[model samples]
Target: MPQANWFPRFRLFLLGVLCVVPSSSLFAQEQPGQFVLTPGVVVDRSANRIFVVEPSDALATVALQSNTGEVLWKNESATRPLSISAGHSLMSLGSVDANRLGVLVLDGDTGKVRAESPLNIPPEAATLAAPLGEGRLDATAVIRGQRGLLRWNYTPPVTKQGLPPGTLSGLPNAELIPEVAQPQPALNDNPGGFVEIDLETGEQSVVDPAAAPNFAPANDAPEQPLLPEIPGPKYLSADGRHVMARERTKGESHRFMMLVFDKQSGEAIGKFPSNVSYVPFYVDEGRIVLQKEEFAEAIDGQLVKQPRQLQALDLNSGEVIWRQPIAEMKFRGPPPP
Candidate 1:
């Protein structure tokens, strides 16, 4: 909960690059390695640290233990994912042009770019994506127009593909996955198809959910595509079957909508009341974190000092486990759950 101003600021005067430039060209003075300031929407946490990407397109990789903030990275243009996922590794995505795009993969141990690639994966708009777990960690990216999913296995001896240039493909006996159906763009939309890749035979199954009795459609309501202004750092459960996200409405009101989806079944679990950001969603454990707030007139003629609180929610039972006021914290923003 550190103030935005508390972080480091790069002084442009130190760089002689601006000396030859005229004053009129200066719409905004650039920091040595920073982007224009904006409120952050995506937050990624791994181990003990949290990385917050500001809306201003600046990157702040913070050490949660020390409560100390540092400019681990930055961007020059106004971008979408101010901060992407920073865990055992960090993934960052940005636009290079209308059709062209780029991705920056950073080593989690040391904030350094391990790879940079152009927008080769289909047209789907995806943020930072990294493979989780051990053994042949792969990168999965959503393919926009094709209504499909694209994954690249990057466990070395990288292969080259026609479209996604650097993507390894058609290996003799490697764990490679070519494509998958894009999950329906509706709330709680269940995964309609399945792909089973065998390590020995390299066989795949495009099983339709409709044919399988074990599977069920996601939600009872109509499908809704994710809104334009959703906060990222989308949380995937330990199995990567569920995703927790915040959908926002732009403008003065800044309304926010909380959504939980099961990627396996393509189902909408539940939408909570009020806007909440720091929620922890674990589907298998039947646990979710939520928050609520209210404003009232103060007893003294001053504004009410407290309006925010947090709670633990049980998704299956649909009940509240606990509630606590967020007033005692020394920070200025919402307290962590």
Candidate 2:
């Protein structure tokens, strides 16, 4: 994967602009003759390349470019590329054609297909997770009435000395988590049970809701509207031992709270108050970067306001090491009507 620092920071900015600014103003600043990026674009900064899928009249175009905006290669064979994953100096492209799902693993530096895997699933089935780790591919797919977990062990091509290239080295091990199904009526409203599959041994085990960590009793206030549930935690420790959960307070204040819990024991360890919702931007080496949008100022004709703050929190202490306000640009658009 591209350097963790640049990838997350760039994604944060992209998400903020998309959420706050209108589409018209977003493209207004593009220079003439520049290639307009579409919806599916993935950047591999560590490999100094950007993968883009360009929609067209027929099949979408897939192209790879250097960090300096130079085209390295273009692939017109694949259909719409849904998502991309990178690891061990390789990039995997998830694509679809008709009723078949395909994965094309590419050389991160050369944009060449090193391996390809095709799967057949119902058209309605969607990929729940596809993370690459330790020269292996772990994925989950969910259909309307079914779900499955899959693991693929990848063996990269090697040289005569039996050593992989520099780009294929230092890959981290994969961490796989199964999706918890809705609570069964027999389980008494506790939806914490999930299936765990051993990718290596092909064994399956069930984790009971009562035994799962971070399992909290449901809020029983009938009059209060339940906030929209986020799919996962706001942050997880590097070792996956701890998770930070976000909850919205009831009543008119509409405030939020962050609580840390043991991943296995489901025990609350620490709690803190927060003004805005946040997402983990970077997590490594005992530090975490949380990105949040405080507020947006709408200029009548200018782009929407950008995020105003960033904070670094220590994983061990759950304390803010530093907080800083992002500098705003001087140029302003017309005031909102």
For residues 43-116, write the lDDT of model 2, one tens digit per residue: 34345444543333233334443323345665544332322333412222344342333445454456555555
TM per candidate: 0.27, 0.27
Which residue segments of model 1 deviate by more than 4 Å?
1-46, 57-87, 95-100, 120-337
> How do the residues 1-337 of candidate 1 rate in per-residue lDDT, one tens digit apiece?
1212211221110011001111111222221112111112222333322333332223233211112223344443212222222133333333334233344444444555544444343211111111111112122322112121213321221222334533445655445555533332221221123333222222334435354222221221223343324446455432234666667756623256567777656577875533345343334345454334444434567766545443456665656655433221111222222
Choose the strongest candidate by lDDT.
2
Stretches of candidate 2 above 4 Å error?
A: 1-93, 96-99, 122-276, 283-337
Against the unseen true structure, what C-alpha lDDT does each candidate score?
A: 0.33, 0.35
Error of 1 at 180 (Å): 41
Clashes by residue pair, model 2: 2-46, 213-266, 214-266, 300-334, 300-335, 301-334, 302-333
Question: Where does candidate 2 have its weakest 10-residue lDDT segment?
Answer: 127-136
Backbone clashes in candidate 1 total 20
